[model samples]
Target: MQKILITCEHGGREIPEKYGPYFQAHQPLLETHRGWDIGALELYKKLVAAGADASFFSETSRLLVELNRSLHHPNLFSDITRQTAEVEREAILEAHYHPYRKQVENAIQTFISQKHSVLHLSVHSFTPELNGEIRNADIGLLYDPQRNTEKEFCARWKQEFEKLDTGLKVRFNYPYRGTADGFTTHLRKLFPDEKYGGIELEVNQKFPQGDKKNWEKVQQIIMQSFYAAVK
Candidate 1:
């Protein structure tokens, strides 16, 4: 048997009320891609909306703590948050980061424990322009090129997506490296090639906010193609 899990690491831009003061002048930053992945959480909802048997969840904000990063990763905290005391940063780690990672890790562990092959899709969105660099990909599927199962799955997925919309730009391992340190990458350490496949799905923020109908169409195409490929 096989299963799918969808998750959004940078979901919302919420700074807990207790820590709101720390981000006083940075409220606008929260609204932008830096704080939380624009449209990622909402898109997560759409992907799993059909009641798929997926263990899905959303993170509050990347600014508070980067859920994608490992325990010792330096970029876990943004510049503003890096200024906080060690105790405060540890609190953020304990309060939010670890639990989220454990939840995902446990989900995979449980599925594979039951002798099920798992196909996990960690949902995310990237800014169109970052530091004056324009990102041309409309959708990015990130998976380890060394993992033949994952690599082939993404290739078939991209083909299916392009079949739906010929003009849609689907790239593999664009903007960021697929094998980069992330939740999926961490899971790979525990599960071998036969039991697990992790792919990070990155969509451009423009679709979610740019047009109402187009966004919905893109959402539908993504879900449809994903199902088709996995089937």
Candidate 2:
């Protein structure tokens, strides 16, 4: 069987030198949740070292493109005016988005050919509050209705995570709902016959930010839970 494959689309939030000034002016917003999920890449690396094969997109600019979002999504930019610059948008899409998606597709295909059962895990982080209400959960799992595998995986994951930390607040399908055309959606559709599983994990940023000790603690807990699930 093939080992599990992990991916983090919004791993880093870095503004390239060319876009540094723009980001600097809007630091409050750009550096916030709009840029990248803080520490997600660090957690992803830990997962990779724990024996899971991982892949991610690399870019030093948030204004460029979002690896997780579909290319056609208007949210690709911080503002719609960015679309006016056709050349820049095209360059960002070609250089970042396309390559990232292609890498994931290739990784899945490679493992399938080896006759391994593939588990797809996408890592992300969420803000404690959106609009005005505070989100009560510490973790959120998103899954699409078309793929029942996501539901099954979330249930198993929740059980494992809760065992690691009894006080941990975990929920199934909250914060963001999985869409049929999302990255996970595309991959599941392409590999319907494989023992394909999809999981979208959302960690509340406050936990890690408030307590450095808790950050590593949660990372270890997640790694252990994932290892158990795949093994």
Best by lDDT: 1
Q: Model 2 reaches what TM-score against the true structure?
A: 0.90
- Show where candidate 1 strays beyond 4 Å: none
lDDT of 2 at 210: 77
lDDT of 1 by residue, 126-216 (tens): 9999999999999999999999879989999998998899888999998899999999999888899888899999999989879989988
Please give, for residues 1-231, the per-residue lDDT of candidate 2 as tens digits: 755778888777666676565555666665677677876778888888888765664544455576666667766666722734788778767767788889888888888787876788888888888899899888888787666666777777888987888888888777777663468866777887346777777888897677889888988998898787665
Candidate 1 lands at a TM-score of 0.97
Runs of candidate 2 with Cα error greater than 4 angstroms are 57-61, 80-84
Per-model TM values vs. the true structure: 0.97, 0.90
